[model samples]
Target: MSNNHGRVINFGAGPSALPEPVLEEAAKGLFNFQNTGIGIAEISHRSKEFTSFIANLESLIRKQLDVPPTHEILFTQGGGSNQFSAVVLNMLARWRLLHPEAPAEEAVMDYVVTGSWSKKAMEEAKRLGGGRVNAVADSRQFSQTGKAFDNIPSHDAYKFSRDPALIYYCENETVDGVEFSHEESSPAAFPFQLLGQSTEKQLLPLVADYSSSFMCRPIPRLADHAIVYAGAQKNIGPAGLTVIIARKDCLVDVDAAARLGAAPVPIMLSWKTLSDSKSLYNTPSVLSIYMTGLVLERIDSLGGLKYFEDLNRRKASKVYAAVKEGQDRGVFQKKVKDGSESWMNVVFEVFGEGAEKRFLDGAEKKGMKGLKGHRSVGGIRVSLYNAITEEQVDTLVTYMNDFVAEETKPKAEQ
Candidate 1:
């Protein structure tokens, strides 16, 4: 094992830190995979080894999440946001197919915009659906912090379910440091009829973008008539490949997934074509698939979803403590909600304008990297993904406190 070299606490939000072992395995496989004399980079995606790899990845995802038989797990290119186009295309096509008599105006999608990614998803859906879209919480803001709204059955959403509108939401916001820990408890389920709704209940399909936090825990029960998608770069294999877990009904939508019938649609956007060939539509990225398999295998060996959730909570708690340590010393304060904060991203802001800049500079000099917050919402963000360690977080905490003390000079200096 290579020493961390004090270069620790890599906190980039997506394409974030991956497990060391996964990286090691990938490095080894670069030259040869499974005794094959060729590098994984050279193997054909259609080769048996690659096929087995893809199958295993799909199986692991399904088994870990306990996704229903009705859901189709697909590996294709395009980030989770691409599903914004995929979902609207497939879903609207189905809606039109189901309610042919309904006016074009009535084919509306209800989106709950909680943060940046959700807003983008809403935009994509509207454009794909051709101006027919309805959004809830079309936007949200945190007041003095503490809570990011209870995702569980908001009074408004539950009330709106009566007549029904196509419901959509981002399961978790990667940028804002908010996550829906439980769909059953989340307002997302409100669009679908609850146990209390009468048998004549009319509910919208509960669609969502489960990108950053997808597969971090067990899949939810009330997520019916839903099409969930994720980008692999964050917690999966790599970028440029988005995985969509669709309820069977959503997969057949022609626009939702480009159908080239084996010819390969543009070599990039054809999800249906990719799914049909088990992701071999053209040549898949072998190293990406191989790394995904090794990662999943490691996850399986560590115990499955139940084990991961506990581990993730612990890691997140450690990161939270680090941020709090900075605050307790008057260096920075968290901006996200108390209980709803994301396990993957911890966001905070320094009190003074120059404070953030000074702290980031110190952190980098101390050997930490990628601690900068995203440009859209800048401050300081520490993304503690699955691979981040408690020791690393502790180091960050220690350094943060020291840096804060160093920066707090007397007013005479000002």
Candidate 2:
């Protein structure tokens, strides 16, 4: 295996690769951050230096994603999993404030279950029990097996509630490698137009879990959603920090809602508390925030999201092309449907006996790691996050092409 400072071209889903330069810069910050004479990990989150750093991080996201004034960028410790329950509690609180006399059953949380993550989020919402949970459009119903998450359901299949507390969907599913297309005309795209029509004049209470796809490209209709949250571990930094872009109105006073007969919310889970304290209600994930800031700064220097959007599109195209070639040769089978395929995570099965293991082992031997899929859905998953450069993708594609050729060869010739 070729060694570049002992680092492999990582293709893991979360806690994925960071740019080499960012790592080098973070290494220095680990020792001394902003010339504070203390490491970033040791620096106080409440200190002026740390606060300024965090503010700049928020600014980077806002400027790059073009977040409107109506939305506030928030940083917190819990990952996207925490936000699943928190979104339910907080959005229900907002709904309860609006409908003081309404019963819990009247408040519905609409979930578009395209993949595993969204299904889990819906389960979490059901577990919380503050409101009714409805699967507005479940992809599994349309899958070949009637259970696998292999496609984005047609927009016509959606059955949104009249006035849902929150309409939730995961922008990208890392495990199943299903993503909503950004193109409005694509069948795989999120049905924003339908939601707009259903909601009428009121702002859509749309909550998107962008954990795997965050910061990889421009967010589609950034201003339309009430909340867009992601774990930094996927494309930004470490696992501890979750970046939340919440509409100003969605940050309701949970205590007041509870007083009005809504379910009580914990202080830490309250978005209003985080916004009031400027995300310093408690000690923040200092190191994760610091590294994430560095990553954003680097992204800005590299021509921002536009550059990444183009680069990542090219990278994913190359991988998908290679997969298609393998499929044509009967050497591989893609898991997801054509239009529903993820640009970030590509999942496909290796054909023939012991072929999957051979594919993974060969990739590892060539210094490419994290090619294995999730345990729940065993196959090959190539996570092409922002940090995975075009050249690295080229290397993997070349390996894939070579593996396909070798597998399709006649056994008699061997």
Candidate 3:
């Protein structure tokens, strides 16, 4: 039996396509890592070999992201979803220490809801029994339909608490295809410019979920953030490992917070636990970490993020151009507002009876897969993660243009 299967152009949102070179490199690790007879999956987490590898993985992220010394990089098991609850608990711990006499009601967590993921994070904060979860700015508020979260709200739309425990935002909304502008001064950029004007004037603790867009581009003002985390599945490696870049100050004493009337933080969920133990607190996703390390090495070898950013911009430009052309032809409709369009996930609709299925079928026949939109939102979502090449994007764009031309072509000609 042949052990090889040719890969398709995968546009999945997560557990998404990885670089072919990285995959090939990782395959060797499954059988033997660095000639150690034991495979990476079978290696002991405490072994020096594994320990050194994990350390290098953390260093790669720090070097790539330009993480400052004030922050520490830690690895954990749960994906971004797990952090939804952990973030609240941990941030609340810090708040409790700072405001020992303040009531729980006084604690506030401002969440900027731009898409499904942020909405879910807000819901998790509410469920975690932390400070009040305030929807400071909801993109849906500006939605013409009043329900769709298809864009980032203007800077003035954010209504942050005076002394909030934490300000939370998702840098990229994977499901709804919304993203903040990388430009710092633009209204479309991260709300930092607006936050600077807050009456409090204190630098509020900020946390961001960068699950889908991590390592895709440079993070603006990254050092100022209290915490930033992303799951390795997208643009990196497999699921199970989540990389957290946390400021030392944010890793507060949860026990101290418990004494101050806050709920006890779970040991496993504690950032301090991971940071103190160097991410070797307990059994970790060994294989996932190993694969992610390989991916990072591959990125470094390929001229780092600058190269990827340029490649990604070009790829996204091509697809969005096709989308615009289709819109003009009345063959497609865009889901995101201008400037808020996600570089990682470009969502749109194909107009006509059974057009969506026809689009999927045509793409599948041409070797594209995972173009289907998320279940909650029906339509097409083209995920242009780092692994997706320019050539693959060109193929998709050509198919898109051809599809639109076919759909708009005269019936008499057919």
Best by TM-score: 2
- Model 3 stretches with alpha carbons more than 4 Å out: 1-4, 199-203
lDDT, candidate 2, equals: 0.93
Candidate 1 lDDT by residue in tens digits, 179-279: 76564554433334342352222334567777787667765663464577778777766666667777665544354322321111243454455556666
Candidate 1 clashing pairs, residues 3+ apart or interchain: 151-186, 151-187, 152-185, 152-186, 152-187, 153-187
Q: Which candidate's lDDT is highest?
A: 2
**Each candidate's clash count:** 6, 0, 0
The worst-scoring run of ten residues by lDDT in candidate 2 lies at: 193-202
Question: In candidate 3, residue 397 scores what lDDT?
Answer: 94
By TM-score rank, best first, the candidates go: 2, 3, 1
Better of 2 and 3 by lDDT: 2
Clashing pairs in 3: none
Worst 10 residues of 3 by lDDT: 195-204
Instruction: Estimate the TM-score of every prediction.
Output: 0.85, 0.98, 0.97
**Predicted structure 1, TM vs. truth:** 0.85
lDDT for 186 in candidate 3 is: 69
